[model samples]
Target chain A: MVDWIAAFSMPLIQNMFIVAAIACVLCGVVGTLVVVKRMVFVTGGIAHTTFGGVGMAYYLMSVFAVSWFTPMIGAAVFAVVSAVIMALPAVSRRMREDSVIGVLWSVGMALGVIFMSLMDRSVVTPRSFESILFGDILLVGNTELKIIAVVTIISLIVIATLFRDLQALTFDETHAKLSGINVTVMNVILYVIIAMTCVVALNVVGIVMVIALITIPAAMSNMFTESLKEMMIVSVILSLIMAFFGLIISIGVDIPPGATVSVTMGVLFVVAIVVKTAFGKITQGKME
Target chain B: MIPIEIKDLSAGYDGRAVFSNVNLELRDRDFLAVIGPNGGGKTTLFKVILGLINPMSGTVKVFGEEPVVSARKIGYVPQNENLDSEYPISAREVVLMGMRSKKGIRPFYSKEDKEAAERAMEYAEVIDFADSRISKLSGGQRQRVYLARALAPEPKILMLDEPTASLDPSMKDCTYDILRKLNKDGVAIMLITHDMSSISHDVKRVACMNHRLIVNDAPEITQEMIALGFHCVPELVHIGSCDCGGHNHG
Candidate 1:
């Protein structure tokens, strides 16, 4: 094996690992709520739908010469707007949640494609749209790492500040409302937080693979935890392990980092389910 | 002090009137069982009082303040079906949720808050299951956990929506006994239930609700009043004086 220790000396490789660590932490913290609240589909919608913003930004840059605007900003804005659209109707029974998600997913992707098609690639920094679909983690730079770090800190602070209210809302929204939590406002805040997470994590896992990183570890952790807090801690640890292993494997095999990481998570999820089932059987036998 | 006062409160959703022109006053230390059919405005009334839904017209005041503003002093137990059993939460953690409004940007619960959670669990006789996962509990046990959660914040009034809908008869008796003890302790109790037989003699004041409010039609609810509230003879009406049998609806 090539000396992994020497590879750490390269700033790019170093930044990649740091970014992975921070991304995994964010996934673990926010993904627990996503799993418990059954918002995986909504999160997926936001991730795929954010392409609309990405497209809008590129289109603006090509046509209007708005050189300062970036796809990241576009992605963030699109993600927030779509999340609000999908989430508001969900709470009020105005529309079925699955239908809302399905509609947004398709429309968002179509908007992104249309925008990208209309852009002139020569005038702006060329980021391959395909790379965005399946991440380019190897090319993550200092600026991307800084952005990720800032988002991670903000997410932690927001989650910490609203911990109890969030707990009530996730467990029982009506109870949360009666507790004077302003459930609608809290729901909106959660959607925004999910939007931010999707935008920041897009750099590490991309749109196609972000849901796997956000949910598989959380599901695995849920199998072993009695409380949401415990689940979050366990999930963070599992996500870090998967990301590190997946990163090393991708380098060794010369494959796409996003797909490798997602496959690693999928394999771990299966392992967890098997182990939990076997452990349950063994314990039941002992009890008998 | 009157813990709850509703004056000409008319509320509904999606522009349909579930109830209108209602007036209600919940006296201190009173155990009022709100009996009605499945969708005959009982829940709408509860929503109005809990400030979850705004009224189309008129006004609702809890402790002489707007219901939304006074929500902190009102302990509420929603229907058991509202909570997902698959969620990873302990009984004690669920109880601590009752103190969320009181917590208010504090990063952690204080020692006194912890004591109150413990005390509430003890009151509901579920202290032994404080650390148990809520999903592992029996239905009756889960209901008690929810009761403890509602009691944790120590509100002047406790509102329960369909607390005994699917429980066994013995469990139903236990739930009523707990509410009676809480009522004796000077906490005003308002329960919304379809099965009037589940409520005991301790619940002297009954509010019959249809598309409108009927307050104190009798010291005890009459079958005629139940018929009015149900709008039709229910398939399985479970009142002490009624003779309806178990009839399944498809």
Candidate 2:
């Protein structure tokens, strides 16, 4: 019912697809690790906490005229810093992990709200608020695409090089420690890549929806996978499918692409859970 | 050199020591069982020997070197933790994971690693489930997989933390048989257990710790060791006699 060729003809749509593919690969890989490590809450904390960096970047750019300080760079720095802080022995020893995360999550968003509010009216764009909070994937240019591509390439390389170590660490920490793998170093690497992927994911799904995009597809794939590698592969494919369809549906309905993608993924996740449960029950009945 | 040597060792958290004046040794092909109450510094001793925690005083050595310096010569299995049933790793994959170290960033496992994993799986009697999902296997099968993971590294000594805590009698015997076989193959074995019920027939040396070490060189667990190490020993309702009040020997 839609003009498919006409949609593909648009440079904006093409660019959106490119960025979504790269970002999804990044998200899918990191999200799989986060899920396996039972650290979805950690990634959620990283994504939301990085918003403080975004607000800080805006503050510097607007008031101090620091043109070189981009919001993406700020997000990356903040994410890594937040992850390292959480990994610190002192912080973990003194406070409950969830408590630290909850505090950071709230304070970061609040800071972003205040910073944006204090910005000059002239500096504020018509779509900045909506786009930054929820994504405007269509607005991503070559520069944004290039940055995400580089990040994805580098992250994938690091993940590949350390895949075995990461597997051991995630599979069993005590065993990994006994086997001579530095558990601390592996945790640092996993968190660093997770934070960086979250920074790139922000451009596609924004701060509020970044967690869902990174988590849902991988989680959905996780339901059907028999291995970590299989989970990531399927997760990346599912993410691509979801992103493309969500974009089409959003364009058709004039809704936000980020919200559309999130809703679509959420619906699929519920359906997958239902089917998995039903299948399991059926098999159990047969065996009995 | 002795596989593990601890002399007058004391370890704890903060500035205060939890247990002190400890002396122990793990010799070649030794099957030693360390038993005590929970929170009686059993895990602390394991940590100290694994170089995870520094001893407050005295010394601990592995192969005549510091614990950290010779850590690679030992394979360790902690208390059974349920790996996420949803995690989709195979038994063989789990075995292969043990071949990794912090030495270098190698992306793929070599053929030698695969062969070593296969051999370990065979040794642990888990080759039957090597291709199966780890979570799909039974408890005994899963335990073997974990054992295979420990064996994959081919260490000179094996340290286990309550390995039979959750297993049934038959499975426990099977695990003990495997440990005995591994011991015969020239690997020193050190096991930590909270109860004597799980201690197998082949465990010859015993150590108990409440606030201090009580090493029993003989084959039996003496009443004095139980009285000092455990707070309240369990009474056996099945038989007329209590378990910890007399000598435990087969």
Candidate 3:
């Protein structure tokens, strides 16, 4: 049997557990709105743009000697700016959202690689660079963990306060606007919130794979729950379960936790589909 | 203040105009019907009146104030509107959303707000499934929930954009009956429809639209008006009567 106590004693493993919980909460809250708003593609666009932020953080830290601009802070700022650009009606009206996303996606990735190339090798170690793309929970330090926690708490609070407005907007915009919610402003705020989440969740799933964490659990919960409130609760719980188990299993197997976690949820989502479909068919047969 | 007053209105998307040089003046207790073809700019007119889009050139007033300021006084149901089938919501919550204008910036509902939602749900005949998931309900049931949501605000005017577009004939009748009841109770109604059969006794006025609007005082359907508004006669079985009931076509 594995020495569970010894594993728990390790500070690195302990940090991994903490990240699992916080990241799950962050994912659950933002993800439910993203899926409901049919903004998965928009989210996917933001997730990729965050890599540009990570690269800029590293570049500014080493080259420009900006000590305060950590990757999380830099990513947060970059993400918000990008999200606002994406949210702008001017941008959408001038060009299709799909085309805009494509442009931003390519530019962000290219910028990331170019910025990494300019950085000193000592600052851009292969493992650390890889960590920016596909996350490693072991890479998170005390500061990163604190940033993730603070951001997650703030996100949760905002979601709680504006839950009604977001709910109405997501379900039907025309009605929400008539009911006195500023639809355009609410949309921009929601986008900014999701962008910050993408930054905070970087250590858990990294930039490239972040959309899976943001979408999978909420979509899975949608199968079981009817109300947005219950769906959010169920989704958070489901995300926590996936994050915890995925962390432990990856630790045991000596694999990448981010990849393992994403795979775990992806598989569970398929299982849910199969179970729901089979159950539906069986009930229909019984009725017949 | 007139409930709705518009003059020389020209509105559309981009640089093109959908409808131009239109005018309207709604009475305090109007039961007006606006008729137009599918692409003849019915929805754009609503957008202008709802303060969703700025008009290229015109003036619009709701209850003597700018439409944006008086938007709360109106309850609107958009055309062919459907929430995501898998969306996480219930009828009661949707109904409560109607009361948002009353409690601005305060997200939580008060006791009175909850009671109003109840009254709306009862009126719409959807109290039985008030707790049911919106996605779980059938088409007709979902329409009633939308109606309940609109009615909960207790607006001075109710605007419905093809509210019964998806319903069967019987459901359409029920929807019109509810609208008539609301009108009789002194709430003005502004409904958009493509159906000529809606030229009924309850409608006090008719506005036909193509690239412009013509407000008809006599609530009667004329072949000339149909030809002008629709741009062409609809290619259907013109049995001289509408399919829903024995409403005349000629």
> What 10-residue stretch in candidate 2 chain A is worst by lDDT?
A118-127
Candidate 2 is scored at a TM of: 0.93
What is the TM-score of each predicted model, taking all chains together? 0.92, 0.93, 0.94
User: Tens-digit lDDT track for model 2 on A1-288?
Assistant: 668799889898888888888998889888888888888888898889877888877877777777677788878888998888777768877899999889888887788778767755576342486788787888777877888899899999998988888887788876677667777778888888988988899888888899888999999988888899999899999988888788788888878988998898888889999999999899889978
Q: Give the TM-score of candidate 3.
A: 0.94
Question: For residues A1-288, what per-residue lDDT tens digits would candidate 1 score against the true structure?
Answer: 667787778887888889889999999989999999999989999999988888989999988988667787898889999888766735437878888888889999999999999888877665787788888887777776888899889988999888878888898987877776777788888988898889877888888888998999999999999998899999999999999999899877878888899999999899999999999999879978
C-alpha lDDT values of all predictions: 0.84, 0.81, 0.82
Q: Which portions of model 1 miss their true places by more than 4 Å?
A: A1-10, A86-93, B217-219, B230-250
B213 Cα displacement, candidate 1 (Å): 3.2
DockQ of each: 0.60, 0.56, 0.71
- lDDT, candidate 3, equals 0.82
Task: Return the top candidate by TM-score.
Answer: 3
lDDT of 2 by residue, B1-250 (tens): 7999999999999878889999999888888998887788988999999888899999999999998777766787766665664577998898887787423447788899999999998888778668887777766677677888888879888998887766656666677778888999999999987546544366878888877988887656788987887557632211122111111111
Q: Name every residue pair that clashes in candidate 3.
A: none
| TM-score ranking from best candidate downward | 3, 2, 1
What candidate 3 keeps of the native contacts, as a fraction, is 0.84
Ranked by TM-score, the better of candidates 1 and 2 is: 2
Give fnat for candidates 1, 2 and onward, in order: 0.78, 0.80, 0.84
